[model samples]
Target: MDVDYVEYEDYTPDNESDNNITTELPFGSSQPSLSHVLVAINILISVIGLGGNSLVIWICLWKMKRTVITTWYLSVAVSDFLFCAFLPLEVFYMMTSHWPFGLVLCKVTSSALFLNMYSYVFLLVLISVDRCVMISFPVWSHNHRTVGKALGVVVLVWVLSALLTLPSLIFRQTTVRGSVTQCYTSYMGPSKHKAVVLTRFICGFLIPFLVIVFCSSVLCVKLRRLTIKSTKPYKVMAALILSFFICWVPYHSFVLSESDLKNHSVEVLETGLKVGTTLAAANSFISPVLYVFIGNDFKKILKRSLTSRIEEAMAEDFRTVGLNHSKSKSMEIVKS
Candidate 1:
């Protein structure tokens, strides 16, 4: 999804000055009640996302012994939790249409949001590739897919995400308009804005999306010949990929429409854009549901207690890692 059209701040690709940053829809517009609705939606999203992702982070980091998959899940949960942390500020901005937060904080919040977004998406791509590797070359994956290697990849993703988000931190400024202050990205010129948007679309969305789709498709086909035990993880991963698309495609579509052409007078597209923002924010919470609670094993354990579920997830992680270790040793012995 284009971060430019994100709900919190106005996205005016026009060569506007730092002081004239757009915040809300036009004055006396028909959607006076829209702000109230957005506040409610964002509040709900914040509550759910914060609660769910916090729990996932705790379980993955403390309860489970580290594994490649657990490490990825931990990074994702941390990112989502941090992202949702800023939603209240968004809610406040929506209600009052003012940014009490200064320039530094504005950049911080915006950068954090995008940082997590790219990190989460890339992590999903990594998971897809990991699953594909495990399915395609089980022995090779067993030997190579260590927790250390996974952490290195995650660190690299964080660095890349941070670099990508540098533009938001640099360009986003807090400008005072009349009595109200608004925080927004201040593009230097038309060409620069276009370049940033195009780069973000390709690097942040399109490339990671394609990688995930291709890897998931191949893993799905390979799952047909695998045992049920091996198949379950791949199935869960496929569901995760599907849920990501369901959540993000609307947002990116709105971004594409807004970026490439003039805004149409059609009210439906306008309404769809707002709905797309809400859904995109909601994705932070939806991930935990799809990745954790969707499985029957998790649900059954969760019924007993949160602790039980954590224990069950941890056991599963260790069990999988232990099996891979044993398999790798056995293969080495056989080859020797």
Candidate 2:
């Protein structure tokens, strides 16, 4: 369940027959070179992603007033925040090549990682649909877009994500071999393992990917027909979708390739898996950059601290008076 690339060592228990073989790793030589590099990458990701995602959650959920898009983003931030929370354990596992936290943590951390990924993609789909609705039927969206409904959908997505993560939890285990501790998914058979990977690729990646693409296409057509000048919102959505695709597609593709897991050598698969996982993990931190660049208000709010935003909120009357003075001056100039 931990983010790991394990090379299992086969052993047969003294009390067991030859047929009762077990796959385990002995406390032998550690892969210090690879472990050091992976540990460094994870530490970097944890520090940046945890901070960026926390800021996003704070801004969208608390600092800014709730809107449909903000509510959707709030869900994403929550998932990323939870994902970041477990990074220390992953880092520890990578550095030492052992699972010290025991079996339950192994299952929970693995399940949480996949759960967050699924939840993230599902939220993106919802955001795309919301945008498509806004563009295609502005009147209906104006009347029907409610925070309560958006929150309800968020709750449903969480439920779905948890359900999807259950298989990983069920399959995950902690195996010890000669003082070496390992956390891994010990599928009953290769068939079962392949099935799980296929399921994840389809449910967690393919379906949501298709939905986002379809929504984007429809939204583009509607905007083109309407002759809209402001495409900032669409641009923001596109950035989000593109980032998600870039970050996740490689991971999913590598996973799907694992259906033929026997063909891959341990060293080769480990390297590829590590690279894919690093890319996938990058999404948590990169998203905040996209938000700042593509979201109109995100940069403005981030530029100022919480106290500054509160002060601005308190000085609403002063800002309104200034705006009125500017308007009056412009009117007089026009008349002259």
Give the winner by TM-score: 2
Q: List the candidate 2 regions with Cα displacement exceeding 4 Å.
A: 6-32, 262-266, 306-336
Summarize candidate 2's per-residue lDDT along 91-171 as a digit string, tens digits: 777767678899899889877678888899999999999998888888999999999999999999999999989987887
Models 1 onward score TM values of 0.80, 0.83
State the C-alpha lDDT per candidate.
Answer: 0.69, 0.74
Our tally of clashes for model 2 stands at 0
TM-score (C-alpha, index-matched) for candidate 1: 0.80
lDDT of 1 by residue, 1-336 (tens): 222233212345234535334333421134658746766877988999999888777667755667898888888888889889987876676667677889888888767657876888888899989988988999999989899999999999999998998888887777676787776665655455667667767887889888987886787688777766545566666776676677777866765665443554434555666677677778788767865656554444344455454555555566676756645544444343
- Provide the lDDT at 82 for model 1: 86
